[model samples]
Target chain A: MSETPGIPAPPEEPSEEQASRIGVDSWVAETERHGRGRGPLWQLARLWEYSPDPVKLLAFVALASTVPFWTNEGDLFVFGLFTLLYAALGLGLNVVVGFAGLLDLGYVAFFGIGAYTYAELSSSQYGIHWPAEATIPIAMAAAALVGVVLGFSARRLLGDYLAIVTLFLGQAFVFFTGVANPTVAGKGLTGGANGIPQLDPLTFFGYQLTSTKQLYFFLLIVVTLLATALYFANQSRTGRAWRALREDPLAAEVMSIPVNRLKILAFVFGAAVAGLCGTIYAAIETAAVSTNFSVSVLIIIYAVVILGGFGSIAGVFVGAIVINCTLEFLEPQNDHPEVKRWLFYGTIVLLIALLKPWFRPVLVLAGTIAFGFVVHAIVAATTAASWTSGVPVSGASWLARWAVIPTGSHGNFNNYLYIGLVVAVVCTASLKGWWRMIALVPTLYLTALVWENMLTQNGGITAFILFGAMLIGLMTVRPQGLLGTARVEIV
Target chain B: MTEAEITATEKAAPPAHPLLKLDSVDTYYGQIHILQGLNLEVQSGELVCLLGGNASGKSTTLKTILGIVQPRNGTVQFEGEDVTSRSTSYRIGKGIAIVPENRRLFGPMTVLENLEMGAYLHAGGAKEDFDRVYTLFPLLHERRRQLAGTLSGGEQQMVAMGRALMAKPRLLLMDEPSMGLAPILVERSFEIIKQVHESGVAMLIVEQNANVSLSIADRGYVLSTGRLVLEGPAAELREHEDLRKAYLGR
Candidate 1:
């Protein structure tokens, strides 16, 4: 009579019913004696749990907080600035989706609102100049107010309907900012496509945060303070209530947790955090562009939050660091293609090394190598040397003879190879053990061929490809992320 | 009283001025009607059982009374006050507690935390309630720090009962407490339920095993296909010919 579908009914299985027939207390005793999640990954999870939190936090802070000093401004901006920015953004999102169990697709709208409000107050576009202290608070308050209003209006809607409403609201925010920027005093208020620029730099107590290093330190400080505050808050009653609401809203409401009020409070907190990040973002870039807060960026933040482990404060940092660094690495390096090329080969090697059953990886590697050379030799012998003359990417010249990269008109000829490669990869996922291994041999070869031909030509497109691959890989491997505990849900 | 003694009673009417009442309740899940014109009542300090086969709207009645599901056209009253439109929490605050089906323990939380959650409205932190629960189910105290998910089915059931008791409710609602338990455990659990019932709280228990529930229940109601078909003292209902054919597997 229990509504939970996945719970095993006593009489459904003979063994269980027989166990129950023996005695009730013994069954419970037997269950306690048995192990849960008996696997290598679960063992690793145990080990992770045994490690102390402060020790891990200190190590992470040491690695992250010093990034601006060692790297160039470009690297610092790419790796340091954006990474921390996204971490803050991701943590904000974790509160709503992970803690409060609310599907707020309109989260980015608050972030956008924070940026626009700050820009309007501090930038030349509006001819207003509020100090950083005043502007940031006002922006955050405005965003929180918006979040409360949205939460109050949508109180009756739950789950999927809530998601749809927030999703539409997000789209409306984009349209209003990008195309529907109403004209005030004979000028477009939001600057339309160009966006509002010439924003004031972050100034504190008669000193200006002019350099990337200063901004990085400021951000590092803010992130640490916020993370600490969130940690304390999570230890309080509010966090427990939020988690209870997330687990089962109906149950929580009945248990006297005040579900609706808690949901709205979650939104307010999430919006405030997002608002802070948005103002800082505008300050860092000296601009607030509508294009900056597009749906893609929203997805990126969601991916980061999910990857780091929902509801985990530390996980968001880890997610942000991994994602932002990878995205930065894939940025167009016209003068230096070695980074992308090395990254591609390194990934393949890593996958091969991690392949299960030890010998299967060796076999797959040997097969891919043999398959490449045999085809290359046959192509060269049958046709011209120029037909198989193209080289491997970067300085890996020894690979040139075996890897068949067509010279001149390196065109849609490889398009078929790439398409086949996609199909082969997808097939490998769906195939069983032996068939998957068999498919992998061709899939590996095709991947190399595709990369050498099409993927290497444009870092822009490959960035997305790499992101998609990483997200899929993370979900399949560890949905809990770096520091999150695995949860069991009723089906 | 022994089974032999129970059969001696043929006429037992419910006490006047029942503590809770559902009048002509009609519930629907989108299109299909569930609890069709269902009327039921539980007297103050009485242990009542609602029995039915699957999809007979047994669980639906509990949900309706708890406000988890709203009846289309009916009134549910608690102590003479209409509670049909009240929120589930509001009803709970008014001395109603439910042991939701399958225990529904917050799996990640420790047994202690789960009990604490049951007393969420208790600002004084329910130390006395916790002690009372521990006294009733000492195994819960032994496994107070253990995660509810790791516990066996029977132990999880105990935790659920202990959790509901922590609310210190005047009325308790349990859905299939005997489910997934061995026969011996069911008897032991029923003993505990009898103790709780004797301690002056009214109870409304929903079950598929009519015989087991009716053994301890003061009175019984049989619901089939969203309607009550029989009602009487537990001793009389247990011997009812129609109930034996459909439920007792005789």
Candidate 2:
């Protein structure tokens, strides 16, 4: 099959040397860009990356600053104080992971250190009483000093090893406060698992912040100032050095950036910020419990940072707000089971609207309703009418008519229904075209049934479930977070 | 290194010391001995090429010199000063520069930024160093704003060399400069190396391309299985029939 005169003579090859360079360079570039994200989310993130800092900061501040004025104090505390605490924590983590590229899984320990330090000084547990002014600064300094020690110890450890060390440190912190509080003057210094109670509220001069509203605004000011300061710091020389080291530590070291020292600096900064957040939170709650600084809290903070985007301050702020608000909605104390039900169904409709084309959405909607009723009828007619006894949440009589409501006691049957519903949802997701539509019908009916009988009673777990799902969804769809720039990293 | 090597190096060291020397260096990657009793030298302001075939410990020598890998025995001396115990960054601080294999430029950084990293030791004269790099590789100056990852092979090679030059190094260590280039580009690269040497930068280059490397090298050493098999003036080494037959496979 020798080529004819014009048949491209086997594509004249570059010298082995030249071709090798080309192959390596192109392959490296292509591979580095392999898992790089794109589409509307990525594009939107890219646009956000180019936004003016002041405008972005001001916009976020304006939206957040209005929350207290328009919402109930409970809503304000939920959306404002906790969100700000998480945002600060997320920003601190961003410095370590996003800027310095260090995976510090024990960041929550620093938060705990701050909280406990504040508790120790201000709480009546050991009859040690101090003003917020002295206690908070001491807590933060103590936390930062601890961070420096950890950083120095872990300076030689790279990446995953560092992560392991930090994670264990976090566990150690929990153990210290939860199980190892030393006996001091006939009372436990840390109060063991019960934690120190009757803590002083944040007080300035003679005036004391007793209300959650005042605490919310106090945290608002702190978060805003911290965000602005962090933004400036990220733009400074140290920031550039941190980013360089993040890209390649060896190169940075070879380039005279003092890689080890910089790593320690990043750790110190992150710890100090976390400590400050913890003090404020402990003061507001008037208690400092070991549970407040567990791995679950770590995951939430990580989710906030990752969800917002790694390097962007704005991203972490937005991430904290969204995650905290969603979590609050799931809390049983919110007294609105209706909100959760509506959110569940609304999410289903949203998914359909997103997944299907115009006419198909209507078709899926109608199909899902009709299918639910048919299944309900089959279960009701064959079994007893009393069998469909598990009541529907809110006043959705139609939903009750459509879904199979078990008549039995609050029993293992609901657990089976929940498991079956999960399996159906998974199957529906895997199926394609008409098969998906067919699967969706039964999945929808099972979902309603489970919500009515199972998830309703188990509202206790709803917060964690929602947060877990949000994390997984975020990692899959847009790992860069809404405000972070999509970075192309070398393997 | 044995006592013989210690005494021999001590006696043979020239009054104007070699810019870089690896005397009876023994290096190992875990249990695998890579460089055994390997002695190599690059005299001040001269170009030296360490020629070897695959797995002949060529890259290991460069890494050892840069302190990325430590030799289990023997000493790495620069300007008659022992630097075997120095860290990689410490060596760089002492005016040693490296253009690693595959041109490991910070892929995401701009060309200018990569050069800036090269001049990290001397932040006071970065502008002057940038000008020098630009003078040597004008193409780099033209595309200084472009991310290094996006550059072509020839351009990246230029960037790598320019980055090394930016450090104002006393001894520049280049690993596999002609490794993956067209014959013409290889020649162009050699011309640049010759120019850098002409400007009084002592360089020790590691390469598999014996012919191209020896053509421009002032002196050459042929290494096989991490031990020196041949050493002479570049011209004599080029014509060494035994080396050509046994190692060069000419």
Candidate 3:
């Protein structure tokens, strides 16, 4: 047939190679245009994206499974086991916040429900000893039932409203389990403040998961299975529908997707996963305490999901590993003060290294060292000797002469120094060009001074503060998260 | 025969009922009454255009038909079944599809994935359905794997039209196909619309550009401030002095 005037004729039929390149041409062209001057990090990211899915999963599983072989029980439990638990929790929340685009802040309540349900069934408080095979499903179902109720109640709400309602529900669960402690069958059902204790170990079929190593392996297997299952689900019809709704609910509805139903399904699915994690966690700890499922735990889980990159399964594992390990290492009881000191300095150095033109990092480091020495020398010359007498926290004893730490009791001196450091950081951020570089020298010195005095003493609070700083940094630098694809909004 | 004579014969032999009918539908956006007791229809296999300038309730009429915005009064019937109380998804499932304004293609999704979403309600025969769309727009087949957002404006319009056709809808509702296109592409888009209309699917094209829409539309309705000002055969509407002055630029 003759083609109409002005309408371009269709191109010749594509060869197999050309056909395969159909949708990829533009992306390849885009990459080529922007490919120059990219660092190794970008190349590494590109490589990671190009690799097959199953290969990535297998590599992660293989690397993670070997932790039990090298590490002792204490390190394994704190680092290895907790990482797996949080990974599971992160995966669940990813479905809600990541997949369905629902900011479900009350997610941790489902975890609590699962823990309490398992505790009631198997703990000594209730005196009902059910096997793990039976109680796990029951706990999951219990959480799912509550999920349906919550989902229905908050069905009409979106974004912050949904978040607020879910937050209230979470707080209600904590109060019901911790403070309210309603009586069921003449016994305080929740045990009021002192949660149910002495829970039986997870016994599946015939084998019991007792030791930390055994439990770790069990969780590894479960998480692997969950990831695999979720991977397939994400590729299925439901996954597409979830993404469709996430992109535009109105458009998805007009295109024949039941958006409300999918939203509720996402909630219930996330709740079920959290419940399963809670059961395993309760089994491992041998207790179900209201304090265990607090807002802090919810924050940690959110940290993992955000760090991992929303809607990414493998990102959950990476996020959990990085966060759990860092938090555990910073614990005061961990007694790794020297390690913490080195970590603090190492991170600052890494941040400086990210500066462009190479010479900037060197200039900043040299300037900071000179600035610290000058400040220390001026204080020693002007003030009393006691002001410079205090020693460093750990192995950096030689550096005591540089950073100022007063010997005797100085009222709110450390507080003043911390406030100075924060003000310096804010000032440095707002400044531009050479002025900013000049500001960083004093800021870096003040950071060291604060770490040596106040922050080292309160490792727990410092860890959270650092975590918050990291999240803010990530948000500014890469709002798509570590592994997520960058999106372009066509306004 | 002339285009006017063809439209005259079509009007002479009216169908038993319209494939889609909105009878005195009253729609509101909160306190703002947008579509005030609007009545519209598209007969089987007919190409009808709803024409009006901005804020003329043209878009609102399309939304009311798709059940995206519920009407306070009157009814929306699809194939003689009242679907006013149904959800948007239900209306879509009952063989109604829309190429929404601004071509709200899921930007993050691939062109193929967006098309797959259009066929969400249909379970089987996707291979054949995909082939049908691919044959209609070969350029879509070429750029099928690219993200919908990355495509050019005219290309995005093609994806939107292809997406709607994937559902195999008996009636297609298009909202402003020529809004963002260049003059040349707008002409090309109308040609495609004419081709699609000839394939036996009824269409209700909501457009602000009256000259282009009326050229191919069998019948047209002129709406002004939430009210239908004029309605007749497209040839007569194009010749009407008021419409020619207001929309057709004489």
Candidate 4:
């Protein structure tokens, strides 16, 4: 099986048992869909497909080359923009995760910290507001300081223990944002729970970027410069030490790789990327909310990394675009039904788990068509529901009330839900065994209900149920996730 | 008690200074005192074979020179350079490399990579050393790309030797290179050692096969209970009546 992040590679390649279920023709067709010759489209496809190191490097260059070409609000441009940002994050993560082999689940916290730093420093509420350019360096320095603090203790821990501590640190950041109530700790630094707002935009020499389209292009340039710097850093002696340590710590120490020093450097470098991303987020969104730095965002970042494949730079960029854009498209508004979107996530994951090499392309095409259909259906159904409910056709109904489909009209979301479940089941069965298909039930349920709760109510009982189901689903079947590979260690 | 008396006694005994010396070296694994004040030495230009039964501290002595084993309460000196406090890489840089007991070649790496790592001490000037290593073991150049783990025992020993030579060490410590080879392979290995000796690298080889080790070794040390029981020139030790009776099986 090809290596995917968080997912274990299938112990053996698909056997006759697997081939017959997913069907050899479908597998072949899917493989062909993913394996076309390289151009712009091929580069986008390669972002999703698992490739070797040289292929990954080629993909990075290809993505980097496309930065200048982003000019519109088209899907590809938005995707390319997200890709550059995530690629930056991945490079930072590569230091801690790839080079050091330290599992850091709370990496997003550092990114958030960087973002918040910029938000606080540049926002009007801070009273000592700086330009965005100045904030970028300050945020980076703050992130590095956090990294040093984490590193001081991180050296003593490894694997699961390190993960727990980092996780705790992430939890602490979330709690602190709310617990303190008002942003600053008497320093009046942050705007507190409301978070910093009205942050400064970036300027190149004298030309200030006022448009979203322009900002995207500016981000593209920053990503290119950073990627080049990271590439050279990876080639340097320090990078070699990181690789050596990743390969074997004891052996590296014996070779005089300066184990502790390298570990600290990796953490600092990884944090710096988070800092840079924070700065970018501050300028692009023009707001910094605690909600923006939530656990969900971290999960999305991880999803990108996992989808792209761990220890892969290009994979991260490709993964970021694919994951973030998909999530964005799915959650068009709160009224968007959870069941349908989750069904989408579950089906994609199932395909990856069972028929990985075969189902990857199938899901991509299938998802695009399904998403377009769902969006069209939601728009029509919600618009009709508003008219029938006897409520005046207001703009608020467009945002929230559409999901209910009104009181009197027989708006059948059940039918759509059933269709989604059936599609998920069929896709799961086609890829592998019926036993594995059983594993999708909870994930599907969670995906549905969680979105329902988030859109309709304040994280009601349904959210708890979904969370519980997800926990159970994770315990069995695809513990590594559908698209991720398990890590192998040799003692 | 006078100075004259002490000088006279010292004159009567062997020279105290050793080319490679371990004095009162106490080694332990947790609570187990594996080596109890082990004292030993090797003279310069001498091909000394450490003879011992299993667990008799033969391999451990070689480990001391390679800086793999740290002596808890004693000193390890190589040509008057105190090496007890130095690291393995430092020792390798200081011209001490070992062909370890199990031939611990980097299994995943190729024979060439393993050899290159052996030259890790002098990593930058690798091309210059490569020709020398290949010359010493031409068979290695042929099997250079082959994974070190998959090679046969005899071939592995050659790669191990070539790897050690890549470091250009003055003292080569070999631990049981003939442990699991055919009789012919064992003889060939011994011949290779003789060739290495002629090439002027001081060797301290450890072996359980007393007769074979004693034959090629310029000098021999018989160890029992971590204490040196016998030490003399190889031929003289070979002819010793007690040695011939116990080790040579004559």
Candidate 5:
């Protein structure tokens, strides 16, 4: 065969004619004559041509706007502030479960480490309080080191084995925090189970982030930054290598991808994000408790990742927002508060066993919309009626009614309306054409505004109830997630 | 003359250093010795096919060359360099690519992705390589975005071949490329083998289909129980009546 100057021969020509085209005399002149590379725009255009979907630029803008008002509200701002932080943590776990296919059972330990790091360095634990700004970097660095240790263990172990080790790591952190009494060294260094109290909020460029609304905006910015960074990381060569490793480790190794290094990077990345969340949590909550970083938290975060979809960044965000909002808004009817806990966890396990095996997409979407509306209505009705009645809220009866089964309060009707709109928006998005996705903006805005209202309220039955409903919706309609699509690869 | 020039002149360029040279390479699967002291070589641009019985270790010979199986003793050399201790990935990194039997395409990935994965090691030059692959197999180009698993057996084979080409290997190793295909596909596959050899890459192929293997092979080796029983030019191997009677269908 006559060899081409620039083009080599095809490995599977299967014919003489095919071989001749590839085996040309010279391709340099031919390639040069084509004259490509106009500018960055041209490069972007070329990429757009190859990619599956056009980028959603509007979503980025809306999410960006939320950061400004995150920490400004009073007590109501606390939930938004924490939600932002927790969502950031979820993104970190996304790298482990989504990108790397590593199941971490002790993710909270990293979060705990961040809290402890912040607590010890700041006024909460130690008398020698460092500036709040300094704690962020310090906490992140410490968490990264712990992540590396976890990564080393992950390289040598796999599947359930890694999960078992991470579970122990979580337990170890809890045990250390619970038992270690370092009063001899300093006044508030360990803080015991009471954790750190009166930890200071972050101050940026002379701007104070003390209120819940202001903190919410701050956290929103932080989570957005983390999510964007993770998105790019997933798109890069390193991220591709991680995805390949997840799909098939042996084959990935054979391709010279350095499977071990990629796994560790994922571990450290996830830990760093978790640590960032902890730093924010300490600032927002004004106190930290061991139970806040308990095993249940791990289960909930894992549920978010799994229910959303593995290897999807968008899915993680959607999962976090849906799960957090529902948990915030819905509570059980007040009469039987005890029943709510069983229902909350039971739904998760049942969905995993039964619904997840089949019809997962349908179930998850339906449940998300349902939960969103239910929480919206309940919270709205509760707030509007309580305000109009000028009723001084009685504590125990309200709790009982919220728990056993919500009796009709003015808030309950609002909850129903909220749930209805949520279902309608989800329906429109799922079934409509391109125009509908564009049109979903107003609906999402309304939903978010209502969502923020319910979340800002102190822990309520409507929030828990909505969360259960959303869980059911997520399990049924879109097991991949509320806003996520299933990814199918051809062999 | 200097020693270097003297040696170069005396050996007729030393036959291009046998793009692949396997010397007494032994391989085993746990207790079973699959390949016992296998020796083989293929010069640059030469098309050599190893012919063997069902359990004669032909497949294992190719696997050993690819470093999928570690050789217990002796050396496996590529381009005059010993690669016995190298990992499979290192072998691939050194521009060695393979089309394993049954076409182990990543079932979930598209044909294009599979081909792209072949050039996974290339990093920057994938688009050029992709265009080159598509030019050779227009059918593959048409179905480039189609899942490799969903394609017919023939299309899947094209993906396997395109993926190997993506690596731009100097030596291509193929194991049973014509394995369960229809007779027509088998003929088509042989043509591909010949074209690939003509593209400046040396080839070492193992096959039970001796007639087709011998047709494209410049030189051929016949293996029986991990030992070389026959070696000759392709024409001579095709005419070997005793070998034909026993192994190839008469």
Candidate 6:
């Protein structure tokens, strides 16, 4: 390692003043240098770090407001509008999980409550057409009331127990709306699994938000207000109290902070924000469905929060944008099969490029391509003609020639290849140095084979699988998330 | 003692009522009893030390006084009010502060923020409190922006003392102030305790370092196995044979 010419030499016997001037101890300086990173991306991150909060918010809003002009109605609703909604919901969850250090798994129940409340009041199913202004506040209050009840019931529980109880609460919401839809005022309150449809658009004093563009703009305004409000809230006395309790509840309690009350406040505040987002989401979709509030939606919201960085107001928007856009781009309904295919391969290439020493990634990429051609030639020469005759999905003829795609039914050949791919991935990850590099050649080829044969057929599931992998990768690389400060645990 | 100094000390008599008092307190952790029918008190403007070895219920006594651990029976009176059932925050709000064991500083927070949390009850009027704390520990002011976790053990101890003082408590509960410090730092810490005591706030120092605690303390209580075995003036306890044998290594 010392023979490397580019690597800087270790410092020798520097004076105490010189060490202090560098702002780090001499022993860890090399590791610190590596961690700090370099190049344009790090410079950009530093710029972002130093910029004022309001300025960043203004810039984000300016960028987001132009979405309606560039995209059509469908794309705007799927990509632009949904991103804002999730950003709003993720911000609310951030309060409970990030600010107060509570793992509130049942947070989506509040979102469902808000949507259903709006549905009952403003939809034809209830025969009561209340204005948006009244229904939104009512929905928020109803959700906040339930939050208070849950917070009081679970006040004595901590950590895993709280997560369990909240998880049950979330499941209960889904079950009640879908299975045990109670009759209220001569109609099924939640309309069973079908839910309450044909909901009226948000009408503030007779100004209806009928068009998709209008709803998108309306949501943009709501998200901006919520983010700004939360930013200020994070700077206030209550914010400090919440952070104190998050760090050490016992210490905060002995320091004159009312822990239980502040905890309940966090629940109520987070629930109310989710409730507000629900009203707008209902307005945009023009319906309320039980399936919309399932555990899957909860997972997506959690993905947004975790990816964005906990306890950071700005991280929610960044996370929502990345997650929602990626999911939308991979959606089968979007009729963009080609885009998904390119994205899958592009991501693999990007990961390979990030490997250290530069030449490793280059070697692995070249070795995998050569190995794929060699395997294809051998398989074609040995196996039946039908075994090697297969076409690639989305018309990628080049990949079809290289990847082992079966032509006939092949009797679970895809399943076997997928299992083999998983094993190969595990082996590659466990090995090190040149052995790992040698192992990656087969793993990469197997991955391409599995993707071309099986994963492309189920685009939705493939999106989720890739999403999970991305989260694991991000967590391993930077557990602090994109915008959060790295915390030090004293124990 | 000098005749004139002894006369000066005698002329300044203690107030009528003690600032803090625990009357026959019994504290339990789950099923195990930690403090068994313990009685303790700290007079206003006095430095009282509670000396005990491991499992002697010394730390539990501090926790019980600060309301972190409530006694099963008997009352804890602060400023002559029965505060046994009050919450920890309520006790803190009523002017009972504690420098907890291990100096449980908020690791991720800045020194200034930790101090701010100590004065949480007196928010918006903590400018003078900051000045008072900075005056006592000037090093804290310089490192105010730095994270408390990054500070040296001695500096962390200073922050803990400054934090407890920020509450402006009438009676402070300190648990093992010299537990992790070097001998010289321990002496400096005891000196600061004396200085803080001279500023008129009462204190109850719980420690295993009986010799050092008793040197600056006005009164001392020795505990073993959840019971107080000795109680007297600090001068008398220093010369007590059993205390010297067990703690002072005479």
Q: Which candidate gets the maximum TM-score versus the true structure? A: 3
Q: What is the DockQ of each candidate?
A: 0.25, 0.25, 0.58, 0.10, 0.15, 0.50
TM-score, chain B only, every model?
Answer: 0.92, 0.92, 0.93, 0.87, 0.91, 0.92
Two-way TM-score contest, 2 vs 4, winner:
2
lDDT of 6 by residue, A190-250 (tens): 9999999999999999999998899888989989998898899888878878888999888
Best by lDDT: 3
**Could you give the candidate ranking by TM-score, starting with the highest?**
3, 6, 1, 2, 5, 4
Higher-ranked by TM-score: 5 or 6:
6
User: What are the per-residue Cα lDDT tens digits for candidate 3 across A168-234?
Assistant: 9899999999999999988999988999889999998878889999999999999999999899989
Candidate 2 residue-wise lDDT, B94-180, digit = tens: 888988787777776678777877776676236778888888888888788777877777888998888888889988888999877
How well is each residue in A149-201 modelled by candidate 2, as lDDT tens digits? Answer: 99999998998999999999999999999999989888887889999888998
Give the distance in Å from residue A478's predicted Cα in candidate 6 to where it truly belongs: 2.9
> Please, what is the TM-score per model?
0.85, 0.83, 0.91, 0.65, 0.69, 0.90
Quote the true-contact fraction of every model.
0.32, 0.29, 0.78, 0.07, 0.22, 0.60
TM-score of predicted model 5? Answer: 0.69
Candidate 3: segments with Cα more than 4 A from true spot: A1-46, A354-360, A423-443, B1-16, B29-33
Supply every candidate's count of residue pairs whose N, Cα or C atoms clash at under 3 angstroms.
0, 4, 0, 14, 82, 0
What local lDDT score does residue A132 receive in model 3, on the 0 to 100 scale? 92
Candidate 2 iRMSD in angstroms: 5.3
Which residue pairs clash within candidate 2? A17-B180, A17-B181, A18-B181, A18-B182
Candidate 5, residue A218: Cα displacement in angstroms equals 1.6
Q: Is candidate 1 or candidate 2 better by DockQ?
A: 2
- Whole-model Cα lDDT per candidate? 0.81, 0.80, 0.86, 0.65, 0.68, 0.85
**Candidate scoring better on DockQ of 1 and 5:** 1
Model 6 global lDDT (CA atoms, 0 to 1): 0.85
Against the hidden true structure, what lDDT does model 1 obtain? 0.81
In candidate 3, the residue pairs with backbone N, CA or C atoms under 3 Å apart (3 or more residues apart, or in different chains) clash, namely none
State which docking tier applies to candidate 6. medium
Best by DockQ: 3
